[model samples]
Target: MSSSLAPGHPQVVVCKWSAELVRSMLDITPHVFVVLDEFDTAYMNPDWELLSRAERVYRISDFDSNEEISAVAADLILRRASIDHIVSFTEFSQFGAGYLEVLLGLTKDPMRHVAFRDKRLMKDRVRLAGVPTANWITLADPSREDDVAAVRETLSFPIVVKPVAGSGAIGTVKVETPDDLLPTLRGIEPDPHLKSDQLTAEEFIPGREYHVDALWSGDTPLYLIVSAYYRPRMSVLDTEPGADADATPPDGSYVVNAEDAPALYSRVTDLHRKVNRALGITGGATHLEVFERPDGELVFSEIATRMAGAWIGAVISECLGYEIHEAIARGVVTGKIPEVRPSRPYLGGLHLRPKGPGRITAIPDEEEMLAVDGVLRAQRLRSAGDSVDHAHPSEWCAFVVLGADTREEYEALARRVCDELRIEVEPAG
Candidate 1:
């Protein structure tokens, strides 16, 4: 058993729904203060032996309500210990984390949390700062014709409509024609928890998409890495049938090649610095997405005030020699940002999603995937007879990490591994 909290140890409060990427944070600190949604307590029960090690835990029945979370956190702080920092890596927990930070007098500007969680607000902040971004409009009433006409006039075809505060590409739709606009809008089911006006319609910039992950101190970037997506996330999210039915599942490959794209790299880093200042991210990790147009123009997509999800941290830790969890912990604990950068030539990773909807009957052997050249790790997310949903990115079943000496070599290995891998599923009855 881990010993009791030692004096002078930073007492970090973590607000989370589950413990996916949270173990490292727990392991690295001696005094942990956990805040969990009451519903997640069941799923987290097995880890109670470990969670009990924390100095304290507060479970709120309504995690979405900032008032409830703040009240519970306030009572916890007053009754038990003084919290040095409030942190959350998950999207859903950001609201509560931010609320707690302000309620406990940790950060003076609470809008940073709002900007980080709300995509609509995030883009507006960047645009206000003179950063180039896709033209966008918020539609409180999807049924309003004036709003639809506004989108047609202000943006080009193939516009993107998504929840104002969504992640993992959930509820995101790409409409290519004005004819499909209203129908697509009607088809979207707004999250009941959000306001009626929380849907955003934005111009979809067609180009190669890339993400910049970095650790920051005020407006200064201590470390950053640029990675390219093998397939745009919308390719996986579009469920309109026809060609999409025959579409291949995403192998989830994102390549980090700073050496080959130094010019674009410089541009993205500069834009990221501007974004951080605009978003008021004084210190912590940030994930920003940008579109490299055909003519080489870079347009801002959106930014998150947390580490990149989708096992990005794992790839970075494996290839760059800096674990994201540790960086976040260190930043939160001591406010000291690590001075580190990508030390590798090229690093790539693949997340395997189900090719179609059905019950998974067979999957490629994990050992075989691991045996592939340049492959570092492989794991199956589902077993035989497990159901697979092909609609959302969250339903993807397997993940593999890789490293290589060059971008071309890494891309080839990633393609071969994805091609050879098989996930067999039987049609639903």
Candidate 2:
């Protein structure tokens, strides 16, 4: 076993408050140590299952700060004499946890983590490294006249305004025209997560969207899966001419097996390798989004140093015959590349979001959702009386994972599930 992972020493996870994470890492180590911020754990309630069973749990006030995270890690080491490893499974905590490792003499410089989370810094690094991405400019304050002029001069229309430090596409929007840019800028409220609500505008790259979920050890990916979205993810931000603004487009993606599309697999893998090199992520799960242009160019979109979300894990489990959620944590702790056992039938998933902002009156149960054909797993995220204010694509209330023999069938089945499944909401007054 690696020095970071001894047989019985506590495996430290600067937790994202995930039960699957605690259970998964426990498989590799006898004891699991979890760290959480008081802010998030209050809402999530870490008293459930595996988290409760952690050998030790540390609650900090400022999880967003690396110093605070490292302090907890340092304190844990003092009490335990030794710790197996340190890692985090969420976007918000990845930097903080990695910094902890650095402080413990396990990792190197921390600028790379900053580059991963800060949109402006991420694009700058990628661009300098000769990676293809949409041209972008950063505004410390979009409300300022100088910053607004810079955007007007530098980026063209239909650009996206994104939070410098954001996750799940929250506080991200598409500004369709130059005339609408100022109004769009004025309309956005301050985001607490971002540093001074800083923004980065990347001129939109037009293409079909895909997300690659991979486990990296050293310079290359040991295991990776590419899945293409059913439609461009940005469509969630789009407004239709005659429809209600909140009428969400059905969201889903089907995995593209390497055997079926060898060329695409090769290209994407190679591109992802370059991205990993440029960005400086050496280990654990990476969820990458990219754009494939009409002329067969792959443009880098964005990446999160965390696992893929929106039922990608369930899709992987259905096709690969294992729970990737826990397997990934297991892989990180034990330093073993996860075994890949590919199974038959093309698989995909649909994310069912609430219709609009409202107190959620009703959400379909697992049994009700499983009535749809070919569904392997149906998960309801919200219940009756649970309120939902769908501001971004990540505000989904349910997930449906399904499979079929052919790619066409997989696509058809995914749509069918979306059309049939319902999230009856009492619309916002």
Candidate 3:
């Protein structure tokens, strides 16, 4: 009999929810049954339902309260079941970890999986263990303007303001001056539903950024892939000429959500490994963002205890010939080490930005762009007549993936891909 698919069905939730993740898990367990506990963020609607029909199915909904969520998690344990493994990959998984312990019947220490939502606390503990980190402070009272002022005085200009306990860069802002502080505060004010832990402010380090995709095997590091950040398309930045002058600077905080470059990836691999050990993060799949200063020092921006978002999973696989998400899922399920060998020496990927702002009126040269040598795949996220904001990566319109034999070959293909593809957005006015 297949595992149950209902909420709190312990055995059914072992498989990952996303298409890419599911495909990877199937490589290990072809007939896997996945109990999707929370469907809102992890999986979309009709697609999820269709997949559930063929595979072992179970569904779960958000509980009315935190207590309910905890209760449901606990009850699943009392009903003894043979769940080969228990796994969680979402932010809410932190809350479920304790409950999963009782349900999984595992003897590992659960407390070691400390809740890492708090930037101040997470960095503090890591730093005390001799990890290199940026100077940061938490403002318990974001309502008090003076506290914001105090942070500015201490961190100086170009400081990053964000919720101390948060992810996705929702209320994150880079304040460049005393005048910019109030405007930045006003911007995040609408996020009133934000948690108190979402109130940390820190100094902004000017450096080139990179991401390390790794796994932890019994406190030993197993790096699956390392990404070189050649370009960063923060949502707050302008997509074109006039958009920059009109919109407020640092309006959005999602880093690498919109666009990235594939050229700088190799140089970053060693740098990330060094910092990962220093930070005392020796397990699980971590998406570590780092900043390489002009002076050659690598500084940390932040690290998420999950995979890098925004098609990065696919990007990593295409560029480096490694399946990172698959490694993470396998490790979570059986506590087994993943075997990953990069198949190619050189590759590249690129996301096209709107040459200018407006509605996406047309993509002029599709076949010509696709015909470019080394271009492996192209996906256009926006369709004709789709309205696009100048501020987000989704609004950027399209992406291209390529495999190459040399760094020069990969870079040349990327430039040609960007140059040949054309995007036209209708002006908002």
Best by lDDT: 2
Best by TM-score: 2
TM-score of each: 0.87, 0.88, 0.74
Alpha-carbon RMSD of each model: 4.2, 3.9, 6.5
Model 1 agreement with the true structure over 1-429: per-residue lDDT tens digits:
333457677777877744533565676676777788865776656377677777777777755787788676667555656677677777777777887777777777878788887888899999999899998988766777887788878877878998888887777888999889988888887655454346788988988888788877666666677888766777754432212233332546465566677887789888987888788787777888899888888899988877887757778776557666777777656666456565446776777655579898887768977888777767777888889867556665777788777767776776676677767788887
Expressed as tens digits, the lDDT of each residue in 1-429 for candidate 3 is 333444432243442356656655655554444545565436555256446543454455542234544554454545434555444555545444434544365535444344344577666765665555678877777768788777777776777777765555555667788788777776664334343544777777776556666566545555445555554433334344212332311211111211243334444545445544544445566777777778867666666666665546556555434566676666755567445444445654565656556777876444555677776656667778877665333334666666666666665655555556667777866
Worst 10 residues of 2 by lDDT: 240-249
lDDT, residue 331, model 2: 62
Number of clashing pairs per prediction, in order:
1, 1, 17
The superposed Cα distance between candidate 3 and the true structure at residue 3, in angstroms, equals 12
Give me the runs in candidate 2 sitting further than 4 Å from their true place: 1-11, 45-55, 65-67, 77-84, 192-195, 237-249, 342-344, 354-362, 384-390
Ranking under TM-score, best-scoring first? 2, 1, 3
- TM-score of model 3 vs. true structure: 0.74
> Considering summed lDDT, which 10 consecutive residues are worst modelled in model 1?
240-249
Error of 2 at 205 (Å): 0.6
How many clashes would you count in candidate 2?
1
